[model samples]
Target: MKKQVCIIGGGPAGLLLGHLLTQEGVDCVVLERRTGDYVLGRIRAGVLEQVTVDLMKRLGLDERMKAEGLPHDGFNLADGERLIRIDIKELTGKEVMVYGQTELTRDLMEASAGRGLEVIYGAEDVELHDIDGANPHVTFTKDGSPRRVNCRFIAGCDGFHGPSRQAIPASVGKDFERVYPFGWLGILADVPPCNHELIYANHERGFALASMRSNTRSRYYIDVPLTEKIEDWSDERIWDELAIRLGPEAAAHITRGPSIEKSIAPLRSYVYAPMRHGSLLLCGDSAHIVPPTGAKGLNLAASDVYYAAEALSAFFGKNDADGIAAYSDKALARVWKSERFSWSLTRLMHRFPEDGDFERAMQVAELDYIASSRAAQTSIAENYVGLPV
Candidate 1:
């Protein structure tokens, strides 16, 4: 099969790119290694930066999200029993939309279907060929039958584990990463949110986050050591730990119930440099991953897509290679900034096992500064709400 572009991975990044291309009269095909249902079922962070929300609106995919998603002007940062509210809207005139990644994915899928999207689900062994050359093609199998797609360009929107990034010869690409020492033990339950806005708690025990998907569906997470096993954490134990970490004030608002979903997600910051090599370009998790603490993972991916789409649009329209050539540089500039923000948040909120007295004191001092200084608060609000598209 032939298309203008071949997008590997049907996740939000790929799907969003496909949507933008199709809207511009550029035809593309999306390949996914899993069933549509399986992709939608994967739980992920939901906080949407303005850039993402704007892109979704432009694609006409925001009807459901705008209606159902919660908008928070600010969030609370807890230090012991004290709550420090960071007023994002008040400080920066911006806010973040709280929606489930699952729901957003569903909306994207539905929008794609409505537009007659060409996506192949359950594509196995998907690989890219001749990306460094003028023409690129994708090879994969479906139901034991080999398939191929020849295209003008290839978009690697698959997650970090996907094949697109590896297609770039190690000689031409570099992977920079920092894996955190802890993981978030998260739980989802059908209960009222402990607060309208999220609370990120820094405690002596560890770090905890009180978040939600909707007014009635609560999602919470507490930092746990790598040695901790998921099987050992009963729902009761999770709540108990959350209460202790979140402190007495926030804990009083907790509405407990049976957990519908539970899992541990390791935190990390990873970026594959030069997001593009010849005709192949990486997007989203395919090229970078941010720790979930700053909620930049999906938003960063969307920013990558925007740069890619803009470049591709110019290339296909006026035969301009400048945009394409500058894609990696421009994308990486913002990528690194987000990496710093997420890394800073992770450092600020988590209790490092190796932290010395001075280190702990520094963390406390930084938090205190942000809570007291309007400038420090604005800096965080700007990054949290996102820099710019």
Candidate 2:
């Protein structure tokens, strides 16, 4: 019936925040509208920056990740047959870990098991009440009965469509969004990746990405028109498109198989400015979204949770309201930088519908510079490994 912090949504963002707060002896409750199985089944990005990994380590959730997760020092950028490698470790002195979001969530869930952390699943019509007031509370129905939890603060970690963001008065926050004309048609197969590291390609036909989940599981994607349907793409067609977009050199290492899963994800860059509204603090997809091109979707969420948890910790530990008060401004600062990186990378690789000679030439020139200039490469590498969060 009461908690220090009531978290909406049991996705990684909500769960991670709750876990971190609990480590600080903060009392929190996580509510999810879906079953745990449903939560764990959602597949998401696998790349993580050091900041995310460090957070997991701090919460004692990185044992499995450190053991099972793959590490990559750099990734490839391709312009047709030409391969441009950006060595993140060489340029930034850091490396990214390739652990899937699902795996990380599972690790977090397991760590909290039997720790007296209350995570209620299948909560229906979850709603926030009195968020603007000093004593904010959350209400939801479980098993056809209404339940409520009063808290000092409420965290709207539920994703973009959840009710938490809508709880804020429309006049209080501004929304910025950019919907791309295309989507990533992706497939998961039990095949080794074409390369040891990820490969991003800009082809005459479209954009392509060669990535992996593990040594035996490969994830690949190619940009397609928004009108394209997953049903229209067969396993063979997907591989063929990848081959063409990846060029002869990269395609030479192709390994093909029946897809275990396939889908098309629309790309969008969205941010709800001022992540905090009174006692209701927004985190992760509930506050911001970035295109998958930069592999920033999950990492950005991690950073959001990182800032939110730190702010909450400061608030409870030292009775410091400044961290909580400035959370919105501080978080938004990093959010915009990441948005710029994701937007720039998306523009550099994808073929826009209105792209003419100059647009294409600009993309080529930028990619060339990144490949040849150490400064250009370092700029990207630092952003990729993540800036100081």
Candidate 3:
């Protein structure tokens, strides 16, 4: 009999892991707290790095994505009327696709249907049992009845709030954390995007971004105090502020409509090392989270699943655990690099109340350097376009 692996959380990480393990002839089950519809409809990250695109193509999951997703060469950094173009393909020889997380989840979930994969939805009383012992188990209530699953190994691909991380012994790993003072107030409107390329604007009022999900749908964000109230912001106020930041050229393209979605996401950077303890391994958001400024959250999560799949395949198919043992360290190496880049990008674009005059001057100087210097521009391009997974 094959060793059983119980995967917690049915997000990208868990789903991708199950897909890969199933291909390798490993028996696994996925437990998710939310229904499939809720998971598929959740709005989140939309940017896909080049490597993520490659992986999806390899998995034969990119057919719809390529058909529906918009490909962009790069974004533009705007300071009022002046614009600095960051040509990603020119610098990194790669491009990024604008496709929502909701779409990706829908695709993956559809692909996983009826593959001898057990995905329990709306699971309640979900708990990890004997995680440190040889026979690890997941206890949950399914359809108003108590149930337990005994497995040889457990994979925690749940988000930060999930119990999988809590199941890990504190002595097994160390965590590094940083929380930003600002949050992004994102809005989705039924309007055409004001710009062809994403516009990251640094303004005296705040940081603003102009992005799009489709030809008729636009996504925008503004840096606001974490305590800022959404009720205080009306549709008129939003459009007024957007016009000032997006500049006069975008005025004609901008349209007004009822916001389809709205949310405030606090910026944070967190990393947990040694992602595995004994037979339990943590992947994706359960292991790390990056600020959204760099568009690394979903991409990083996908990368984690990709690496975890490779390790699990090696360990199960070839009786080699070396790859599994090195999971956390290998993943974190890329995680921290992304964390730093995200921090750098966030600081460069956002104006903090606590920043002194000298710091403000430094910020401007750095932006100028990035806009004027070819070497600096290439560095930003390499990161923005994303490195290979």
Candidate 4:
């Protein structure tokens, strides 16, 4: 009998897993709650770690990314007047790529089309059945019709709010979470980027970042109060604040353009233990989530799916469950490492309104240490460029 898998959430995790399974002659179905256009248009992380880029190339998904994506050697850490360059390649011998998650999703979507793989979009009433049994099923409603898909296993890549997380018994899993006091108010402009490398600025006002999406389009963010309203920030206020944080060096290059997209992303670190429950396995944000400070969100999701594909291939093809049983352990090893790295970076850059003198001094010391020590810099460089998967 052929082993079949039902993958929930059609994001990088689900789609990539589907593609990998198909290559191994395993039948798979992907169910997504959102339409293709919405998923492909959603603005998310743009940094691809070295490991993820390598996987894309090995999997034959790098042509489009390489053509359109920008390769960033490093990013700038600005302390108001002085700019420090953290050359990633010099420190880690690896380079990070700036390719939006949406672009990658589009590439995988187009590649998966007409491959005899079922991709159901705009699905509703999504649920998992028989998760503890050998045969797990994904049931959902499509076009007002109820549908049921039975498979040998189920991979949950549905994200933080998806239903797959609920399938695991609460008693068996421990939820760990830390919510930051501030959030990122991100914006995309029609203007070009102010600098060639991403700028991470720390100022008394707050934290600000200047990054790019493409040659002509720019993506920027400002650390703002969690309670701040988007309507309260006008173009003038945003530009003024950005100018102050980015400093005069970048002021000339900063151009005014229509703010096409704007939203606040709450910073948080969350993880759940034991990513598997019998035949059902979880991947991506469905299993863990880290703050975007380290640019590990999308890359980590891709890593989870990559591991899942390998484990499933071994289990079905060679009767090996070692990889499957060790899936959570393997993925979390990197997840927690990223979680700590993101938390450390976030603490160093973002200023808290309620921070005491000790905390502020501690942050300064951390930054100085990272800048002065080769080992500390290497740690940042390795994590920033990404670890081997």
Candidate 5:
């Protein structure tokens, strides 16, 4: 196979990039190590910033999203006593769309064949070669046969565990990471959400989040020590914890149901420098990760793809290389800002085992100040709604 670009990982990032490139008349192929069903089965964040929503709109893929997705003007922050609502629309004049990452990926995936975007699923042992040279190629096994894709550029849209990032020479890449001491024990149920808008609660016990995929599909989470196991947590037990942690007002409306899906996901903030290494550009989790507190994961990936598609389009459509050369610095600037916001929100909303009384007091004071100050609320709202892309 030969193409202008070979995209590793058929997740949302890779598919989105592939579609954008194909729309721009650039030939690209996507390689995925998992089946399409397996990719869509993975539960992920549901919030959509303007950058992500706009990308779908630009690609003519926002029909179902605009029809079915919930648009929220604000979210709540609970400090054990009261909910401090940040009116994101009033503060930043923007709203976030509540749409699952799965649905968004499905939209891209389903449209691929009709749009002539090529995605190869279940590709095994994918590897990159000669990324530092002018010509780069990707190789993998499809079924029992060995296959290779010779392309001008390689896109590493694979997640953190994927091999794309590791293909770069260790001496050429630098990493910054912080792994949280705890993980989020989450439950997805068929009941309605406790509140109309999302809620992030900081309680004496721990941290909890009340969110939803739709009016009928509620998603809830509570922070737990990394040593905790999912099997130990029952649906009733999780509801009980959420009731006490989210405060009585919100809990009054809680609808209990059996969990359709449950799991524990660890939190981490990570970034790899120089998202671009010669002809290989790392996008999404392959280059950066943010704690879920800020809901920046998929949106960050969208922004990276936006920049990448622009760069690649310029290079192929107009024979311009400036965008390609500047992609890393441009993408990293936004990535770091998002990292700071996610880190800050995680610190404010979660109780650390190592935190002392003074630290708790500081958290309380900060919450009190935020509750009383419009400036503080505005800052939070701006970041929550997402900064300009």
Candidate 6:
């Protein structure tokens, strides 16, 4: 096979980039190591920043999202006693769309054929060759036969564990990471959310989040030790913990139900420098990972795709290489800002095992300041709603 670009990982990032490139008349193919069903089965963050929503809108894929997705003007930050609502709309003149990442991926995947974007699923042992050279190619097994795609560029949207990032020689790449001591034990249930808007609560016990996919499907999480087992947590036990951690008002509105899905996800903030290396451009998790404290994972991926598509489109459509040359610095500038926001939010909301009484006091003081000051609230609101692309 031959193409202008070979996109590794048929996840949202790769698929979105493929569609965008196709719109610009750039020939590209997407390869996935897993089946489409497996990709959609993975639960992920729901909040959509404007950059993500705009990309979907640009691709004419926002019909179902605009119809079914919830738009929130604000979210709450609780400090055990009261809710500190940050009015994102009022502060930043923007709002976030609460639509599950699965739904968005489904939209992109379903539209691939109609948009002339070819996606190959269940590709095995995908490997990249000659990435540092002007010409790069990818090889993998499809069914029992080996297949190779010769392309001008390759997109490493395969995520954190995928082969794309690993293909970059250690001498050419550097990693910065912080693994949180805790993980989020989350539950998805068929019940209305405890509140109309999302809430990040800091309680005496730990950290908890109250959010939803829709009016009928609620998603909630509580921080747990990295050693905690999902099997040990029952539906009722999780609900009870949420009640105590979210405070009295939210608990009164809580509705309990069987979990449609339950899991424990470890938190980490990771970033790989120089998202672009020769003919390879790393997008999404392959390049960076946020702690999920501010729901930046998928949105960050969208932004990366936005830049990658532009760079590739310029290279192919206009014979311009400036976008490709500047892609890493432009994307990383935004990536680091987002990383800082996610890290700050995670530190503010979660209780660390190593934290002392002074740390707790500092948290209280910060929360109190945020509650009383509009400037503080505005700062949080702007970051939560997302900064500019």
Instruction: Give the number of the best model, judged by lDDT.
Output: 5
Measured with C-alpha atoms, the lDDT of residue 137 in candidate 4 is 80
Q: lDDT by residue for model 6 over 126-244, one digit each (tens)?
A: 99999999899999999979999999999999999999999999998799999999999999999999999999999999999999999999999999999999999999999999999
TM-score of model 3 vs. true structure: 0.96
Per-residue lDDT of model 2, residues 207-291, tens digit only: 9999999999999999999999899999999999999999888899999999989999999999998899889999999999899
Model 3, 1-389: lDDT tens digits are 12389889998778877877887788888999999988987778788998678777877789999999999998888776667899998887789999988887777788887666678898887898787777888889989998888888889998999999998888888999988999988889988898888888888788889888888889998888999988888877888888887677765678878898887889899998878887788888898988888799888887887878888888778988888888878888888888889989888888887988898889788888988998999999888877666
Q: How close is candidate 4 to the true structure, as a TM-score?
A: 0.97
Give the residue spans of candidate 1 off by over 4 A: none
**With candidate 2 superimposed using the best TM-score fit, by how many Å does residue 311's alpha carbon deviate from the native?**
1.4
In order of appearance, the predictions have TM-scores of 0.99, 0.99, 0.96, 0.97, 0.99, 0.99
The residue ranges of model 3 lying beyond 4 angstroms of the native Cα positions read: 1-3
Model 1 lDDT on a 0 to 1 scale = 0.92
Residue 185 deviation, candidate 5, in Å?
0.3
Q: Mind giving the per-residue lDDT tens digits that candidate 4 earns over 34-59? A: 99998887889889987678767866
Supply candidate 4's per-residue lDDT for 331. 89
The residue-level lDDT of candidate 6 at 28 comes to 96
State the lDDT of candidate 1 residue by residue for 121-158, as single tens digits: 99999989999898889999999999999999999999
lDDT of each: 0.92, 0.92, 0.84, 0.86, 0.96, 0.95
Q: What is the lDDT of candidate 2?
A: 0.92
Q: In candidate 5, which residue ranges exceed 4 Å CA deviation?
A: none
Q: Give lDDT: candidate 2, residue 189.
A: 92
What are the root-mean-square deviations of the candidates from the true structure over C-alphas?
Answer: 0.8, 0.8, 1.7, 1.6, 0.6, 0.6
What candidate 4 gets wrong by more than 4 Å, as runs, is 1-3
**Under the 3 Å rule for N, CA and C atoms, how many clashes does model 3 have?**
0
